[model samples]
Structures are given as C-alpha cells and as structure tokens.
Target: MKVLVTGAAGSIGRVVTVGLAELGHVVVGLDRVPQPDGEDSAWHTVDATDADAVAAVFEEESPDAVVHLAGHPGEASLPDSLTSHVVTTGALLDAMVEHDVRRLVYASSNHAVGRTPRGGPPEAGPVGADARLRPDTFYGVAKVAAEALMSLYADRYGIDAVACRIGSFLERPETVRHLATWLSPDDCVRMVAAALTAPAPGFAVLYGISHNTRAWWDLAPGRALGYEPRDDAEDFAGIIEARPEDEAEAAHVGGPYATAQFERPALDRTS
Candidate 1:
C-alpha cells in the first residue's frame, strides 16, 4: 500500500516512515523541513497548517494510508501555543478530507486522558474505550481536538480513523512511570502499522502503550487494530533506579506531565 507520513523528519515520523517501508509499503515522507537534494525519502516540503498545500500533496500522492504526524506542537505558554497547535491540526484534517482519503492513523497522546486518576490498585477489569476526554493542558487539548476530527472524518465521511492515544516512547525504559508507559520504538512501529492495515477501524480511540506491569492506559479496543505490543519494561527494572519519592509521586500520577516544564518540556512528545 502507498503510505504518506507527514512530519517525516520528526522523531516518531521518521521511525514510522522507515518502519512502513521495512514492512514492504511504499512510503512518502512529507515535511516543512527541507529535504536533502538526493534523499532516499520520497520527500515533499509543505506547511501542514496550510490546507491547500497539504491537500495538493495528498492529491498528488494518492496514498492509501496517511499517518498525520505534522503539527505545531503545544507549549505551556497558554494561548500562543494553543493557537499554533490547534490551527495546524485543523489544517491537517481539512486536507485529508479534501482528498477523500480514508484509513488515517492519527498520532494522539496519553495527555488526552492524562488528568484521569491512575489507580495504584489494579482495577477489576481493564479501562474502557469510552473514557472521558479530560486533558490537563493546552497540549492535551489540541490532541483532543485532533482526535475529535478523526471521529468526524470517520463517521461522517465514511473514513477509517484510528486515533492512537500513545503513551511515552522513550529511548530507554528509565523512570518508574516509564516502566508503565514506555512505548519502545519497535512497539511504536507495530501500533501504527496495525492501525493502518486494520480491515475496519471506524472511529476508534485506542491507547498506544506497550505491555507493562504498571500500565493504566486501556488497550481493549486496540484488539481490532491487531496491535500486539511486544516490548516490556520489566526486563530493565533492575538497571534503572526509580526517581526520588517526591518526584516519583508526581510523575507516577496520571498527571505526571502536569509537572512537566511547559515552557520547554524535556519530554519528547513526537516520539
């Protein structure tokens, strides 16, 4: 299948592009970042916030699947950050619609439900897919809006939308919170690939997290997507020390990222 990965130069987008190619799909890398003169990527330079430009690429490529990863990422500085991110995501959806393209694997975030309490005790059963969208920050708000767009495009336009509410994707499973939420690079590849190829994923919001002992994000709806996450953080528990009790307290909470420096967040959301 032909695939288009917007924001292909970004951390996660790069991986997704390469991963799809390795899986034998023809992949095109789209980004505002200028491509090298003789690049291997079927690269295109376009602003995601400009629907006209984005649509032109989609129309030209006519990709069977689109992994919408491009956006002006949110920052904690209130309204300015929100404007950039919210506007960019809107452009992404409008363009996708204009082309009559379906099968979109949206790159959403755990922050969409980050404010929900993370239970210390295991719930009787896993969390449901119908959980509320209670975001903790402007960043999370943008994700919620984007996820809503996916729903609208799928239900109203007869498209297939898989909003992967991705958890943390780290280079190494270090922090205690990461042990529960870590989505390794390989697992990231698997989740996105599953969402793209799923026969029928009509308007679904599924968590993109690996199997770990402390995981709180629900994965029940992801079964239809065929996402069998293979990595586990437990194997590295002994090598990484936990954060101090106070820091761990905040980080282990569902709002762990609430403590994150919004002005210059250290965490890599793109991953």
Candidate 2:
C-alpha cells in the first residue's frame, strides 16, 4: 500500500514514515518544512492547511491511505487550535474525498478525554474508547471537533477513518504518570499500521498506548482493529522518577493538561 504521512519531519512522523517503509508500504512524506537529510521517502514541501497544496499532493501521489500527523502539537487559542487541527483535517478530508482515498489513520490525542477522572484497576475498569468527550483544553476541544468531522465524512462518504487517541508518545517512560500512559515508538507504528489495514473500519476510535500493565485506557478497541501493541511501560517503571505532582497529574486522564496551566482565554484579543 502507498501511504502518505503528513508532518513527516516530526518526531512521530519520522518514526511512522520509516517504520511503514520497513513494513513494505511505499511511503510518501508531506510537511511544511524541507525533508530532513538522510531520509529517503518521497517528500513534498506543503502545509496541510492549504487545501490546494494538499489536493495537489493527493492527485500526484494517489496514495491508498493517509496518516495525518500535521498541525500545532501544543495548546493554543481556540481559533488557532481550530485552524491547526480542524482546518487542516478538513483540507485533508476534502482532498481524500476528491482523490478517492479510502483510508485515514488520524493522530488524535488522549486530551480529547482529558477531563475524565482516572478510573481503572482497583477503582474501576479501564476507560473505554466509547467514553464521552471531556476535553481538557482548546487543543483537546479541537481534537474532538476534528473527530466529529471524520465521523461525518465516514458516514456520508463511506470512508474508513480511524482516530487513535494517542497517550504520552515518548522514547521511554520518564515519569510515574508515563508508566500508565506511555506509547512506545514501536507501538505507535503498530497502531498506525493496524488502522491502515483494518478491513472496512468505517469510523473507529482507539486509545494509542502500548500493552502496559498499568494502563488506564482499554486496549480492546485497538485489538479489535488488529492493533496488538507489544511494549509495556511498566518494564521501565523502576527507572521512572516519581515526582510530587504525579498524584495531581494522575487525577485526570489528561494529566497536567486538565489543570489551570492550560486554561487560557478563548480568543487572543490582543492579537
């Protein structure tokens, strides 16, 4: 399968692009910046926000699927968040519609349910993928909105869309909270590959995390889609630094994103 990955120069994108290629899928990369040195995937210098540029890439590459990892990766004002997440998604979906691309594997975030109180193991079962949205910040809200768009497109157009609400994607578990939330680089690739090849998953949401013993989110949804994550964050638990704020961060599924530090005015009035 020929796959197009946006944000190809990013941390996760870089991993996914190379990983997919290693899995024998023809990989094509798209990003606003120039492709990094030593990388061999077919590269396109185009911002995802520009519908025309995205469309042009779709027409030229004619990919079988897309792994959308574009847009701002951090908190922003509401409008900026919408543009970075929603608008960019809209452009890709529109391009997919035009180009007849059938599959999309989105890089959604755990913050889409950031405000949900942590409950799993002793207290209750892990949070299911069908849990209601409790977005922690503008960034989370944008993710929810983008997901709604994917659902709409899936239903109306018969496009197979899979939204993976990724947890803390890191090289290794660095903190106590990460013990339950870390998504290993290898697992991230596995998740995307499964989402890409799952047979006719019309519209699905799956938590993106490794097979961690301390996981707070259910992996059943991902497993249903053939995403069998292998890494377990608990393997590195002994090396993780436990900080005083770990309890507070673990209070909600979104960690510190649900806290006051991310609370900002809806609009940037000064700008």
Using TM-score as the measure, which candidate wins? 2
**Residue 194 CA error for candidate 1 (Å)?**
0.5
Tens digit of per-residue lDDT, candidate 1, span 1-271: 9988887888788788888899999999888898645559688898777778878888888888788787654445445445455566666667667876777887888878776665445644445568777776777877887777677767788888888887877766877777777888898999999999888778888888887776667666776679988788887788877556435334423445555443354343656
Off by over 4 Å in 2: 119-123
Model 2, residue 257: displacement in angstroms?
A: 0.2
Residues 149-172 of candidate 2 have per-residue lDDT tens digits of 999999999999999999999999
Model 2 worst lDDT run, 10 consecutive residues:
118-127
Candidate 2's TM-score: 0.98
lDDT per model, in order?
0.75, 0.94
**Runs with alpha carbons beyond 4 Å of true place in candidate 1:** 36-39, 72-74, 78-85, 124-126, 245-255, 260-271
Backbone clashes for every candidate come to 0, 0
After the best TM-score superposition of candidate 1, give how far the Cα of residue 220 lies from its true spot, in angstroms. Answer: 1.8
